[model samples]
Target: MAPKTIIQQESLLQYQCELGEGSLWDAVRQRLYFVDILGCKIFTYEPSTGKHGYQSFDRNVTALALLEDNTGLLAALQDGLAFISFDQLPFPPTNSPSTYKRLNVDITHLEGFNRFNEACVDPSGKRWIVGTMMHEQGFPGSAGGGLYSISKSGDGLTAELLLDQLTVSNGMGWTKYNKTMYFTDSLRKEIGKYDYDIDTGAVSNKVIFSNVDDEELGVPDGMCQDDQYGIWSARWGSGKVIRFTPQGEIDLIVHLPQALNVTSCIFGGPNLDELYVTSAREGTTAEQIKRHPSNGDLFVVKGLGFRGKERTRFQGSFLA
Candidate 1:
């Protein structure tokens, strides 16, 4: 067995978050975005100018994706999806009533403790795939969560349920060719691979791509793929971001010593050679928090000698 390559990480932002997830890189704007689910905040940071800001909301803002044509951002709130124009939001954002244009998608079926989780855009930028999870932790197969794909249908938006019975539908990404798709069900402790059809926005031939049987290594949370077909998955409780080969083999692990609950990661920076990671301090004990003071801070891993493809933006139309 080849030895696992270990890499060190550095803190990028000291802004504390209860549950910092949904790492995204807007290549066109050269900025990074992420969300604090429990904090109800969406943060933005420009690497070039060191200008960091955030927009707070009354409800949980779990995930975000850039919109095509630079219209704005597609945000996954607690109940449903919405559109937020960054140009309209103030710099050094305030906790004003969220200025998002809520999309007309019926999510009342996901009542009770269920809420939106991770979301991503298809490689072609034609569809938005978002997942749901129960607010409280439930056993595998116990939670009635699901994954859905949203697209523009004529003048309005339509949502198609793709997968159901998920405990925690988390990260998702596509291959460079858009022929393969990867998704993570955190409580299942595995990542699934599927045959992807970009034209039809469908996934089939689902199979377990990687399974983390060791509890100490933590479950797979959020992930992004590289140009070389490596899946970089953030391990929730292990303070590690692992890189798995296309064949489901571990090739590299990036360690963030101060972050025990690593949430998500994405590639950014001028050359796209850097990896930006988000962490959580939500479920930590007082002692654990004391030990890892920067548990909820964002971090970056550099000098990996590899890069990722630019993420696609949501091309769907917004509600008037």
Candidate 2:
């Protein structure tokens, strides 16, 4: 067997967000989008121009899905989902909030003290899967954080509950064949696999894909899969990312020394060989922040000899 190759990680940006998550890359426009959950902001970056900017929101924005038409982003906000067009950036272009319209689907029934956490578009581009977690004091699977599915078609947006009893529903990814779906419940410290149906976007046969000891490897957060089906998991407290095979075998690990909280990650760059990482500065003391200044910054890993799949866009007329 050939020797293992070491991947190099470097800080790409220095914008310290309180809780940065969800990194999505738009290949056609060559732009990268991410969110600062605690800071209540969404960020955009252009590598060619070396420009980094953000847009503020009244509520926490957890995740974002690139629109199929590449015109805007589908945002999972504190109240519900919304469509944010690119034309209103830098400023709203107008003082009116009409540029950011919340969908008709109401998630307040599902969110008691918690809000939407992490979300992604399904491989078919027709279904958007979002997960939530308890924002206050509670153990894992407590406070009624659950998984939800929002079907988007020409008709409109409709929401449905899929699973309940979760503390922090984090990373999610699907196998290349779209037959297996992997989901991470951070509080449970386990990644669960489900038999997935591409036609209906239904999942069943839930089983354990991998388990992490919080004290040992840290809680599993955001995740993405490479073209080879290797699942790359961003570890929260451990400040690292681990690569595992579909069978749950550890293959490689990438460590970020400049960060204390590794929130999420995604594959980007021209060829999708680059891994963009996001971290958090929340719950840290000023002293700790002084020590690690890049805590809430964005980083990237390149020269990994691996490439990741392009993010699936949401195919919905709601944003049209």
RMSD of each: 2.0, 2.8
Instruction: Report how far residue 71 has shifted in candidate 2, in Å.
Output: 1.6
Please list the C-alpha lDDT of all candidates, in the order they appear: 0.84, 0.81
lDDT string, candidate 2, 1-320, tens digits = 32253443457898888899999888887778899998878888887777877877788889998888777888898768888877755431233333487877745444444788899888998889998877677553355688888886344577777777777888999987899889998878889999988898778899999887856467899998899989999888777888898778877888787787888988888899988999999877888777667889999888888898887898865544
Q: Tell me the TM-score of each prediction against the true structure.
A: 0.93, 0.91
Clashing residue pairs in candidate 1, if any?
none
Off by over 4 Å in 1: 92-97, 107-113, 135-142
- Residue 203, model 2: lDDT of 80
Instruction: Encode model 1's per-residue lDDT on 1-320: one tens digit a residue.
Output: 76376656458898878999998998987889898999988888899988888887879989888887687888888888888887645555666766788887754444324788899988888889999886565544356678888888776678887877677889898776889889998988989988988998878899999888876578899998888978999998888899988788887888887888999999999989899999999899999888778899999888887898788887765745
Cα misplacement distance, residue 274 of candidate 1 (Å): 0.8
In candidate 2 the C-alpha lDDT for residue 75 amounts to 89
Count clashing residue pairs per candidate: 0, 0
* Error of model 2, residue 157, in angstroms: 1.0
